[model samples]
Target: MPDAGHPAAGAAGGSVPHRPARLPLVLLRSPWFIGLTVVTLACIVAVFTGPLGRPLDVALNLVLAALDLATAANAFSTARHFPSRPVRRLALGVGLIATIYLISDLTEAVGTATGLLASQETLANVTIVGSNLVLLGLLLRYPTGARSRSDRLTFWLDAGSVLVGAGVITWCLMLGPRREGWSLEHLATALGTAVLLAMVAFAVVRLMLSKRPPLARAPTIWAVGSTFVLYASSLVHASPELLLRIGLADDLASSFLMMVALWTHRVQLRLDPDILRRRRRKPFSALPYLAMAAMFVVVVFVVPEGLGMRSISALGGLAVISLLVVLRQLLAFAGNAQLLRRLDRTLVDLRAHQHRLRALLDHAYDITLTVDPRGRMSYLSPAVERTLGVPPAALRGSRWRTPLHPQDARNLMRAVPALLAAAGTTVTWQVRARSTDGTWRWLEVVCTNLLHEPAVCGVVCNARDVTESRDLHDRLRFQAFHDPLTGLANRMLFTERLIAALTEVPEKPVSVLLLDLDGFKEINDVWGHHAGDTVLVTVASRLTAAVRDQDTVARLGGDEFGVLLVGTDRAEAERVTERLERQLEEPMALDPGPAEATVRVVAGASIGIATRDGECFPDPSPPVDAMLKAADAQMYRRKRLRRTGGGRQTGRG
Candidate 1:
């Protein structure tokens, strides 16, 4: 549904505007057109100055009144065609006044034609006075776009202040002057005229003081001009000579102004429906000051001529004006002080909020960073010093990748574009970064893209030092796959590596060696299990040192040990077996106590070797269990030969 108060909305709701001819609107707006119209009206008024009889004069007056009525009716009818309720109501008031004027003019014209001028003149005067009062009431009640109580109050205050100053001047110039031997009728006429003048003053003030007037500025200006001309015409009627010469001329000029106002109103309405709804508030008005200055001028001019009752009265009014000015200034000062106080409170609240936010960011365990789209750090939180061992200022405006390890930096570069592509998303990654001490530390970083947010127009990164946790995890994993006593690969990891070397690349040569410690039970009985453990530890170290770095060395339970050598053929396996024998031949030291001397013992082992090459497994890879069984059988066979004195003797097996 369209808004009923706005003409544009009504037009959208299917109301067709009555478009008037543009010729009249153009002519009315032109200065030359107005001057020509005034000249024509003056000529018409000059016709009344001729020695024309009463009937012809009455006929001319009737024609002029009819013309005025037609223009007023045209304006009212056009306003009715529009949807604006305010314009229609305003037009109704103008139409009522125009109708009363036409009726007053008709009464005098008809009475003159019928030779009943005395009674009709009184009726006309009464009607004019009533119309003036009605006009003043309308000026007070009519809406002038003041929508709030404060706005309306301010409008009236400014208007009242200006009116007071103008009233003082009007009294001094016109009303204060006393004429000799005035009759009762003359006195009554003077009082009525004074009242009418005050009414005109108020209308002019209201028109000028309203910041957002109900009508368009140009139309309202034309309307105010018409009011001034009508008021002047009413005053001229007091002089018989002026009345005979230019009385009708005043009416014609006023009608011209009214006609222009109506035409301008129509033109504006056709152009834009809500053109009159201009809202602007000025903080200051010079009207009161201007009024005060005028009052001072009046006092200066009036006091120089001698202090009479009028002078005394003017002085009193001046004092009242000065007090009003002071009171208004005080109110303005109070408003300004209240505004300043409110601004200070708002600023304090903002500062407190900022303080709390900074405190949280500083105390957090995470090192938060604000990074721009170009990957430069805009802000690094104070927590960075505690976590990264570097102050925040050292990293700000630098690239986020600056502290990252080269390999991690490359990985992060690959991931960052994908992260930024999904704007406003959060992603977590663990990367290595170099701390201030030049050691790489693991960091768990969470990044969120917030470039679209006004307050945080960047990517937010929350990085935590996770190096301790990472080290603990690595230790746990190592314990799971390694021997706790010797820090060597356990049976599980040895089997896994052997299987991988055989199955992953079946064509590669691989070798496995199994050795059982000789006379290990005798040593445990002679030196106790403590010395036995030391012997096992020394043997494990020697075996690991003898094998290639890539070979797997593991304790295969009890006093047995195993080695896995990848990419080794039978010849290389035999040479590695010889090296292991030589390493075991080196003595193992067993210290009993501080009180006892250190004893030397030799730890020897019966060794077995199994090799897999293209010749051993021509097509399919050898099974892991098969390789272990082969190595074990060979080791047992060598032990039996050593016991039977059939194997080569290096040391006691």
Candidate 2:
């Protein structure tokens, strides 16, 4: 036989070895061949032995031998396929012992009454029993491909029970003739009783301890228990007090044991009735249980008692039980075959789905991830590898909070529970994540809790690196609020500040100073707008530098500027406006001087002060507009005073 690890000579590499075609047919695998051979041999033996008497017993012996031969051959075949050395040895040893027992039994059957009690037969039986014990031990202790701990334990118990039975037979053969009824030397009766009691006790304990709910609660246990109890009760009745003691006791014990065995068989059938039903449904392996049950029913209902029908019925019942067991096994084999096919299809579908999802994720630009309710990452798309430069696998099985920026991590942790509770709500935040290149990248993540969809099952976050966009937005917003020419507050922003100051100073005094450069138009016409703009910008900077930081300086329009003095009294506001005017009046050295124009331009301003009483400025609008108009009127009055040779009034108008 070829070893399990070795390939057949003509087979391709990595392929399993094929069984040799010339080997003897297997009873289980090639049942037709073995069945036919056994039946033909039994028929021949029965024909020669005559119709009645010992012909049936001779045929039974032949059938038993055939079964033993088949078991031995299969054991050898299985031994060659075993990968473990100890298991192989165990199988081979069992096969050898079985072969020996088969030969001895066959020899005894042929020799009939003369050779049945020979020493060779006894030795063969003992060897077979001993080898089976060794095999059972190996099966229990050693791990096999298909056997579990429970299966091993069951095998050990079964083998031990059989050994106990064989020991009883051996004792009976050795000492049955040497003593009277119920004597110690009538060992068969005593040992047989002991074996029956032991078997029932073991069965009860096994049934009670079994993890399988069906077996643990099975009625078979009670049936077997009653059988042994009945037999033991019959032994008590064997005394002279009971009439026709031996005959009645033997009859009752045998009948009760047979009935109990049959009942146990029926209970097993009920426990797994589908097994027989399924077997009948199959085309190749039909229900042997149905046939067996039919035979038992016929014998019980129709057979006459005078023709030794009781013995025939008992034999028929045994056959029925065996057939039922075999049928159930066949159904289990079919179910396993169907399950394997379904598993293969499921695996194939799973692989295909995985491949498609992988492709979609790998090609996407956005970094997508799924997080659990605890804010731990459950899944990350492949795009994370390309976008964040971090492999998806690397981020898997890690908490999302760990990857967040330190400043944001605490807030994110707190938000997780709330987000989970809200279900469909989306939360957005900016976080920093470590990239594959070991640099931190700013990620704007929008996470939506998909609690609405059972399939979604997690928080889905779609993140993108928005650093460039954020920077651009900040720059654009700054430009919108500030003057591009001078980089100072623009008209739009100055108006907003004016409104804010008026609203803020409900009881406090506030002032607005409006300044316009004197003779600025002539300077611009001669020196060009570019030179004029440079001068205006210079003046605005000086004004900004002179004022307190809280004060506002803005280029209101062409050649006009405004300042809103916060928290200032009328005196302080006058002093600040004077200081700004003086700074602007300072001579600017214009570039490209032929120095012919040689001009020193004086810049002056009009000041307006607004102090809030309880009712003077009741609304925000009037106060802000009035402040600017007052400042403008004061500036005109001052310019007229300067032209008329009147001294300039610095007081608030």
Candidate 3:
């Protein structure tokens, strides 16, 4: 950052020495400035020494005309270079008003030297009023504080008073010019000048009372120079008409200083303008005031003006005006301080509320968060460490999305916008959130848009771990459709499967195979139900191993099993039945109990096969019971054939 006085500080803070503008350097560097200085010097010399001849006076008039053009160029430069918006605008406004003064001066000068016009009094009057108003505007725009809504009415009212005072004084001065008491024109001009100086004093005092950067101090110092020249030109003079020439020099000097101030500030800041840093407070400097006063005293002696009663009264009036200006500034600053304190307190309270609200949100669920309108994460509650295994600090500004499970992230991205656009509605969904340990857990999230609320101007989302609950639900659903003992489809499930296969077949042929364990009831009566259960489990495993993966095996009842095969013809069904019989008749090892030794068990299947195709399959689809009844009758007939025949006879047909 550049120094405080520089625009790089933003006219805000810090301290830097105020550098005096080198007017001589300006005179040397710019031909325009040098030319204006020479013309002004000639005019000043003419004011003191014009007794040599009329030619000298005519020469002085020409110089005055040249000064008009020079001053305009000066105003243009000042307007362009002025740093802040208010100052730039004020300078431009002053430049506009100064143009009127420039015109009037040039007219009178040209009229005197070349005899171009009859009278220039009207132009002169306009100059006097217009220039003073412009000066008044500059003072008002000086940095003090911005207007607040509460003070706006009062500010306008005060401005109205200034207008009224100017009007009354101008009217009185105009009347006096016609009557011959005090010249109305001179008094009006003096009144305008006085009010303008008072405004400058107001700005100066306010600036002095506060902590100001050196840039700020430069203006105040220039204002003092202006006040000095304005007062000295008028106070020492007998006629206000005679004071115009000297006053013109002062006004020109004022504009010159303003232009220089702008240039110096810009140069100090360099490429990085420091306009935003705040100004710091410092003790008031009495040296500049003392130096100016000393300078003023010397000018008084040189001009040889005695301190008369009128002079005393004038001095007293100027002091009173300055005092009133100071009083008004003090009140304004006092009000500004009070308002600043209130604003600070409000900010503190807001911070406190934010802290408390966050604490509550952290403990509300496994993880809570807020997402901005653009889907950026604005807040992440502390419980994220427990739920998502993410640290609280790690998930700022949409970073939470980075660790989401791939499929879940896609789901959230698609769902978030639709949820926010729901407007006052809440959406709940389950997604898999990846943890820090690289495991994915299922989370059920409830999300709501609270964008309209001041406290939460984003979407509030609360998520809880639901992986355990989901797993439990799946297990319960599986158990409802599967047999507990053999881990196959139960009788209830087998009936449903048979019905579905019948409806689909002929399009894809269907076959059902049912079998009973031969002599299995004798083993159960001898060994116990536990040994029988072990044999059944062995039979189920073998049966599953024998068939195609697409086939469904079910324990239909005690020692009875069924297989519903879809997309199979009669040949395929016969081959599968032969495989199942072989696997079941093989030996099986059984554990009766912890107290008992292991038992060897064997079981053979008495098989029955039923088939359906386009011809045999009923058009409306045969009932599940009809299919089961056919299989059961065939199983009984096979059982009788096996008993009649010898040596584990195969009765599968």
The candidate maximizing lDDT is 1
Off by over 4 Å in 2: 1-336, 370-418, 430-442, 450-459, 501-510, 569-571, 592-602, 607-623, 643-647, 651-653
Model 1 Cα shift for residue 50 (angstroms): 7.7
> Any idea what lDDT model 1 has?
0.73
Candidate 3 lDDT, tens digit per residue, 439-476?
Answer: 88888888876766667766788888898998898788
For model 1, residues 42-118, the per-residue Cα lDDT tens digits are: 55755666665685568556755765576567667766765657556667777787788787777778778888777
Off by over 4 Å in 3: 1-335, 361-365, 370-379, 388-426, 434-440, 448-460, 491-519, 556-566, 592-599, 606-613, 618-653
Supply the TM-score for candidate 2.
Answer: 0.46
Top-down lDDT ranking = 1, 3, 2
Q: Estimate each model's TM-score.
A: 0.49, 0.46, 0.47
CA displacement after TM-score superposition, residue 214 of candidate 1 (Å): 1.3
Residue pairs in clash, model 1: none
lDDT of 2 by residue, 1-653 (tens): 00112111112124575433322222134554445445645454444444443555455456556655655665576566555575467557656755775775577567664545545446544754565455445434443222565344443333343333333323332232322234454445656555544454444333332332121122344434444443443244234434233332332333233332333333334334432223211122122343345445544543443333233434444454454455456556766787799999999999999999889877887888987544457789887887777777888978776666777786675555545545577788877877767777778989886745668656789998876787788789879888888888888888898788777656666677777777778778878887788788788889899998988888888888888787776667778867876787687756536756655555454443443322334443455677777677777777777667675675445
Regarding lDDT, does 1 or 3 come out ahead?
1
How many steric overlaps does candidate 3 have? 23
Which candidate leads in TM-score? 1
